[model samples]
Target: MIDSHIHADTRPFEDFEAMAVSGIREAVTCAHDPLEMLSSDVVMAHFRRILKVDPHRAALNGLKLHTALGVHPRAIPHDYMKVLEELPELLSDPSVVAVGEIGLDSGSETEMNVFIEQLRIADETDRRVIVHTPRSGKEEITPLIADLLSQHIDERRAVIEHVNMDVIPLLIESDFMLGLTVQPEKLTPQEAVQILKEYGTDRFVLNSDMSSSPSDPLSVPRTVHRMRISGFGEGDIMRVSEKNIRKFLKIKN
Candidate 1:
């Protein structure tokens, strides 16, 4: 199964090594670097290292990797315009499946401006996007993002993460894909299964959102297990856990 969204680059190397063996067939490792925290070269180097997948090392774990390259809202530096300017070239890498983990956190004007421009870049590059919605202001920010996205790009090409029950309808109305993050601070696996039960799984995907936090690396597999116990059918499970993400990334298998 594919872990559609995970900050694999932010975790300790040993943790990531262990995670690669934990039943995740593949992972979309979103960039967690706020450009200011690391030079563009340094960040790209990290992706290179992550994607290297030493044949011998990968033989042990059996995990293939993909990447998303963009500035996270919290990681946005003071000279964010400079960062955005560099993104087009950086995002051109073949291993990058999307332009994201990018969007507003506190609804700062600066973050909004940067988020909108990144959406434009994603469109221009013909890559899908992974957006981060604010934790507290879903009602306000979700539609704001929806409006901005409608102006610049196709909502179907974007997957907005961190969605909860309240924001689900708003994003659905806007025609954006929904992501449920399973972790300690965010929603749990059981809650996600219940949401899937209510809404169905056609436009939904599950993620661990496991970054530097104390979140579990096995979150997605555990969620799959929980989903089975909840009586979710295999086809529905495949839709949310695997097929939906592959469709979003435009992957064949």
Candidate 2:
């Protein structure tokens, strides 16, 4: 089984290692460095040298936690133009499988600059992107990315993560995919069911988006289980769980 996005914070690497030790195949590790809110304080917090996150590490030790590198929206500061300028070398690291959790946040102007810059970085590095967008009235961000990714058709592909009703049209028009993270309690099974019904299953992928939320049910595997109850067939479920993620990440699972 696979969980699309995994973080080492709430569930640290040792725990990740143990899970991989048990039977899991693989997972992708991402860190939360939201650039949108990256005030001067947050700027100081990012590991400027993100490539060296863990040089002592190798996929061999456990379930092989691959990495997706990017300066998240909440971490973008006034001087972010400088950071974006340096992202190419950081993304070139061998451990980077994708460039993500990076995208627009309606939250601030700083975030917008970072998003556009990150889009540029995605283009220059010739890598796939994993988008993270907030739920707000402004759904245009998704399509903006589609247009951006479309420009680099031969070199880049993208997946917009954590979408809602506003994102459906964007999903249909573009070649990119939509992500549906599992949050059973927050949405009530009925609301989730209605959402699944409103947006039929094709091109819809699932991710845990697991961060501080550690309730066992909110984990990646559990997200799959909830989708199953919502009536998604095995083929549909596997496509979201494995195929879509694999295609976007450009890796074999």
Candidate 3:
């Protein structure tokens, strides 16, 4: 199973061999900012480790792990565009699966500009687009994103992460896949029902937005149970959880 958004290697370069042993197949790890990771503040304020996770851990394993270097919305700084200009080397990495955690948020103009730059990179590379929309105050930016996405046509596979506000329709109507997270509370059974009825059974998926916090990584399974409680059929759950997710990401890859 894939934790579509994770900080598995935040500081210690903590490999997922333990998570793999625990039964998860793989995860997509992302961090906030390069400066934050390399900053004195992480250790000074949060007492978090500031070590950079080596990408060689991905090479250490074959089927059990892969890494996606997320140029996250929160991470893009003043010189980030220049850094991004030099990212072709990183983008072409064998382990890099997608180009994201890189969309709009409740950030400053600087962050938004960086988001657009990353969007441009994804468009150029024609890879899977992972979106990270904030909980509120992001609707006004959709038109801008749509304009960028419109150029990619049928090849740009879109996946929006940690979606809590109602943007499923936009994703469904457009060419992207909407991934819902089941955390902070477990009673969003309504989300599954809403997606199935409103967006049909093809483009919706569930994800574990795990981080340093203790979370059930089997978030997709919990979502399936909730869907079952909400009157969805077993076939519907199977299709959304197992079949559709792989289908969408495979198309993206």
Candidate 4:
């Protein structure tokens, strides 16, 4: 199975191995700006390692990795445009799939600028975009992002992430793809199954969105299992967990 959105670079090696053992065949790993404690080079190298297909845990565990390069909205730096300027070169690499995890956090002007600029880059490069929306205030911010992206991005090339019940309708109104992150304190595996039950497969994609939290990296696989037991046949689970994402990214299994 493919976990469409995961911060695998930020996860421990053991987690990658464990995820592989649990049937994660591929993951779309995204890069974030360095925290105040770390240097930007360190963050860049993390994405580079995945792009290089480092003979590290990801490869050793039989997990194929693809990457997305962008400044995570919450991590935007003072010189955020520098990050934007460097994106074209990174997106030029075939290993990178999208310009992503880029969108509003607090809905600040700076965050919105970074988001719009990245949208332009994605449009110019004809690359897929993965947008991040806040867990709270999604109703207020989703429309703003939808408006900005409507002007600058190809709706079909973008996938909005971390979506929940309230924001689901908002995303559905747009032509863009939607992702459900099955992580702790976010959307649970059962909730995802229920959502698929109600929403049907369509353009929906499921992800672990696994990060530094105690979130389950095996959430995608677990959700698939629960979905199967819930009388959702293999085709239904496949459409949500794999097919939808493959169609969005134009990737082969």
Candidate 5:
């Protein structure tokens, strides 16, 4: 199985081995600035680590790690323009699968501007995007994100992530894929499976979104287990755990 979204850099090294054992053969680690003090240089280094260093770390534990690079809204720096300027070249790296961990957080103008700019870059470069929706104001922010996505990129090219019940109906009809992040703060494994039962598995994918926060690195696999016990068929299980994300990201392997 594949963990469709995670910040592997923020996770403990041992977690990779555990994830591999739990059936996570591949994963996508999205860029996020965890520190309060952010700079273009800091952001670049983070991207470099994900693109260069982290893959080797994951491989050592028997996992294939792909990456998504972008300026996260919460982590937007003072010299964010510099980071944006260098994004195209960094994104060209073969390990990069998307432009992400990018989206609205505070609902401020700056965050919106940066999010739109990344959307444009993703469109121009024809890369998939992993969009973040905040836990606090998802009710208000998600629609705005949907509207912006309509203007900036194709719906099929993005996954509106960290989704919850409040915003599910808002994105259910759209062409965009919905990311069900199984985390402590997000849905539990049972809840994620219930969602799949209600909505069907046509455009839903599962992820851990594991990072510095309290997260379950094995959440994706755990959810797969939940699906099996919930009477979900193998095809349904495969769609959420692996197939949907592979198709969404155009991942050949």
Candidate 6:
């Protein structure tokens, strides 16, 4: 199985081993702000760690780690345009799969600009995107995000992450895939499984979104187990846990 979104840099090495044991063969660790005062240099270092360091760490624990690089809205620094200027080159790295963890947090004008810019870069570069939708104001902010996305890039090129029941209807009919994150603050395993049952697994993928905050590293595999016990078919389980994300990220393996 593959965790479509995660923050492996913030996790202990043992979590990777536990994830491996839980049947996660691969994961995509996205760039996020780890500091209170972020800078262009800090963002670059964070990107490098996910691109270079985390892969080695995951490999050592018997998992393959892929990465996504972007300026998360919550983490954007004053010199964020500098990071944007350097993004295209960093995204060229083979281990980098998408331009993501990017999107609106506070609905600020700056967040809107940065979100649109990254979407443009992803579109121009033909990379996939993982757009974030914050838990707060998701209902109000999601439609705005959908509007911006419709204007900037192809819907097939992105997944709107951290979607709940309310946000699902906004993108359910669109070409963009929906990411169901299983965390303490996000959907529980049962709720995620119920979503797959109600909506079908065709356009849905599962993720942990695990970071330094309260999260379950084994969320994906645990959810897979839930699906099995819930009598979901093998094909459906595969679609949500692995196949959909592989196709979304264009991952060969």
> If scored against the real structure, what TM-score would every candidate get?
0.89, 0.75, 0.72, 0.93, 0.98, 0.98
- In model 4, the runs with Cα more than 4 Å from the true position are 37-46, 53-55
Which stretches of candidate 6 lie above 4 Å from their native place?
none
Model 4, 56-78: lDDT tens digits are: 56877788878888878777666
TM-score of 2: 0.75
Q: Return whichever of 1 and 5 wins on lDDT.
A: 5
lDDT of 5 by residue, 135-247 (tens): 89899999999999989999999999998888999899899999999999889999999899999998899999999888999999999999999999999999999999999
Q: Candidate 3 residues 15-35, lDDT tens each? A: 355445444455565544534
- Which pairs in model 6 have colliding backbones? none
lDDT against the true structure, each candidate: 0.79, 0.61, 0.56, 0.81, 0.92, 0.92
Write the residue-wise lDDT of candidate 1 on 9-50 in tens digits: 556555556666666777787876523554545555554554
**Candidate that beats the other on TM-score, 2 or 3, i.e. the better one:** 2
Misplaced by over 4 Å in model 5 are: none
Residue pairs clashing, model 3: none
Q: Which ten residues in a row have the lowest lDDT in candidate 6?
A: 32-41
How many residue pairs clash in each candidate at the backbone level? 0, 12, 0, 0, 0, 0
RMSD of 5: 0.8
lDDT preference between candidates 3 and 6, better one: 6
Better of 1 and 6 by TM-score: 6
TM-score of 6: 0.98
* Positional deviation of residue 175's Cα in model 5 after best superposition, in angstroms: 0.4
